[model samples]
Target: MTRPRIRWHIPVFLAPAVVIYTAVMIFPLVNTLRLALFSKIDQERVFVGLDNFRTLFFDPIWSEQFWNALGNNFWFFLIHMLVQNPIGIVLAAILSHPRLRFSALYRSAIFVPTILSFVIVGFAWKLILSPIWGIAPSMLDAVGLKSLFAPWLGKEEYALTTLALISVWQFVGIPMMLIYAALLSIPDEVIEAGEVDGITGMAAFWKIKLPLILPSIGIISILTFVGNFNAFDLIYASQGALAGPDYSTDILGTFMYRTFFGFQLQLGDPHMGSAIASAMFAIILVGVCLYLYGVQSRMRRYQL
Candidate 1:
């Protein structure tokens, strides 16, 4: 066979990104993993193998908080998957209608919050939900539903769910945009084909459009999983580092931050913090892998 010329320019063009990624991402990740494997002993770092992880999982003090945080993370993720993604899909479906008026305005209004700063969203929501001098109660009272107004952010039972809904409100546009694009990418011929067979309206959507958007939905699910697990800023900004009323809003990110940096009088433990970070990494990695192997594989088979 004739030899092909090398595309030397490809690697040359990629060199800068490769170098920067290595320095910014790879180096830090490796360092964090390394740190997780060691602990401070006698004012010096010493190799402790998986001792930190052991403490994290089994030690009464750390285990309780760790498990609670892990559970909270799962709940946070579940809320997004159940509420946010479905609502986004519905919104996308509505907006994608051929005769929908001012669809552009509706899209802009919904998507604007996605681009807003998390800090701003968190703070604004906190103020609006405040029991005293807040609009939520006033608005509810105006509609004769003031009995439903409670200090949602301050209650342990409701705090996490409330925060999750706020997050959904802020970022639901992401899934909407993604699904909308996916819907638009469906060939006109496919819709016409469905219509010729007497499929129309909601039937057309459920049978035709939804099937074609499975891959996009799967992608959105994975993104929601990753994003929810990594969530921190909103909780931190709204509820402080403690993620209270009693750490009810705590997730892996906030837990790691508290452990790594220390809050108030609690002393920081970098090794333990790294261990938490490593656990978060493993959880996200395993979830993504499962989706790829379990979900994506099935999706491909179905397509075939």
Candidate 2:
């Protein structure tokens, strides 16, 4: 075979994106990792190797917060995976029905919150869920569930779970849209064949539709995992950087932010903060890798 000529224009076209990504993402990430390897002693930078990590995992003060945040983060992710994706899939399946009226309207209504700013969603929810002057109590009273309406966001036992549900409510549209697209892509012939075999309704979904969308669902799961672990904005907006109710709602993201930037009286510690960030990076990287190698490998994308 003759040698194929390399296209110089390929690099030329790719240069801008490569440069932008390196400048914005890769360089900052590398700098953070480097920062994690050092500490400031008496305002002087000192290389400490893995000492920060050692402290994070072994030292009582730091380790306590680290493990607490990690556990809360996992619980947050679990809640999303269990409640959010299933709800999205159900909504998508209903919206995908050929006879459904005003499907576009239902899709738009469901998706509106996903487009809202995190700050807006968080604060709006905080206000609505507030015990003082909030309508949630009144609404609950209307439904004869007034006794169940507690200040969920202010209670340690319920704060994290409440926030996770709020996040689920806001982002459910993402999986819905993704799975909806995948469902729409299924050829009518395949579905017709499925129907001919007495697979219709939920049966069609379980046997014909679900397997085809496994790849998309895997993608959503990974995305949710990464997003939850990296989550900060909504928590910060709703609960503040303190992640109050005694820090019961703190996740790795808020913890890293508070460490790096510091709160009202706390001094910023960039080195330790970077260490936390690096730890989170590792977690997200491992989760993504598992999804790709463990889950995605088995979910072969159906051609039909």
Candidate 3:
């Protein structure tokens, strides 16, 4: 008797998703890169090769802005790493305590801001910070510290950092939830074993829990890297596309948007815009690859 032929159904199941992904993501990406090769001349697109990238990197005017924005973007990522993740981990630890009361309510309240629109968050912060209608100055005045209050979003020195901190406030809940879930996944018996070995409370967390959560922290780090680099909505909503105060807060996303769609006198330059986008894609890819090969491999070894 002839054996029945085996058939693979997994590809059949995945074909539609693959098609959708190619159509929505991969095709657009390839098209953008292709567009980067052409420049506009008298409103006619002309092949320019690497000219756009040359201008982006080597030209003093463009290079200065590019490097400055890149540096600021790195700083933004660093702030989230230093402040947001640590705070979230701490909150998660506190919330995970077996004896903690109203943990659900606390978690819900803390996470509420993450669901709000960037526009809403930005405008709400703007109003609260407005020197005239806002309560911030008055509240500071009540504490005799009104001198410290200023239009932070309007200041060149403070605008980017201020927006970074505001973003941290809104998204800290994500890390908190991830870490909380990771912490909960640890076997209770292992924790009890730690307790028996004279490890309890902070000692238990630092010695036992923290080690187990390193992988989760790595994931959080990479996620923060990608998110901070791609961040545009909060900055745009609060500071506008120009990232005002003379472009003090212009990250890659806003810069690319302004480059792609002309703002004011500067006509849209699609070629340069695509180059910027390609640069961003390259940066993100490098970051992800580093995390995957370096940090993730080490994490796996530690896990084993």
Candidate 4:
């Protein structure tokens, strides 16, 4: 009997998607990286090698802002890792409890903010925290802690942290859902075995469930890292491109935006902007690599 011929139509089915992805994503990415190596000369594009990158890292005027923005971006990621993930895990644990009532309702309510546009969330929080509006101060007073109510968003020392926390509040649902799914995937028999082995309640979560959920936690951590580094919308909406006061909340994303598009007194510089984008891509690549090789590999070992 003749062997059936293998189908050759698979590539045809995937061709459109591949073509579109290349055009929209891959081509733009490659072009941007190429642009990073070129500079403009009297309205003409000219190759400049790594001069833009060198200036970004070595020139005093640019280096200061570059390092400052990079540091702020790391701190922003750290905050999400510390605050958001823990809160999400705890909320997930509580929501996953068998005894918990209205689980769906609670989940929906908590997740509502994540579905809102960054503009809406930013502006809404701005108004809610406005000193003139008296909402924040009044709410604090109702709780008998009025002195704790400061214009946190307006203070340079507090603006970044405040905005970071707001972003945390908005995005916490993602991790919570991810973790909740991980928890739900745990077999009842395995959980019962843990109970038989004297692991119950919090101990079960810590010793049994937590170990099984390490992979999901690692994924959440990496997602948080990427999201925090690439964050722009909330900061831009709330603090504007200047990232005031006096650029205290300026992160790489906003810095890249202002550099690329120009803001106020500054003229746009596409080469410098592309260099910044390339730097951001490098940072994110490094982070993902570390997570995959370091955190994820260790987690897999533990799972095995």
Q: Write model 4 residue lDDT over 1-304, tens digit each, in one string.
A: 9999867798889999999999999999999999999999999999999999999999999999999899999889988999999999999999999889999999999999999999999999999999999999999999999999889999999999999999998999999999999999888888899889988989999998898898999999999988888999999999999999888999999999999999888899999999999999999999999998888877753332
Candidate 3's residue-wise lDDT over 119-226, tens digit each? Answer: 999999988888778698899999999999989888999888888889999999999999999988888888999999999989999999999999999999999999
- lDDT (10s digit) by residue, model 1, range 164-242: 9999999999999999999888888888988999999999999989988999999999999999889999999999999
For candidate 4, the C-alpha RMSD (Å) to the true structure equals 2.2
What is the TM-score of each predicted model, taking all chains together? Answer: 0.95, 0.95, 0.94, 0.95
lDDT of 4 at 101: 92
List the candidates ranked by lDDT, beginning with the highest: 1, 2, 4, 3
Candidate 2 matches the true fold with a TM-score of 0.95
Q: Give lDDT for model 2.
A: 0.94
List, in order, the clash count of every candidate structure: 0, 0, 0, 0
> Against the unseen true structure, what C-alpha lDDT does each candidate score?
0.94, 0.94, 0.91, 0.93
The parts of candidate 4 lying over 4 Å away from their true place are 1-8, 301-304
In model 1, which regions exceed 4 Å deviation?
1-11, 301-304
Poorly placed runs, candidate 2 (over 4 Å): 1-11
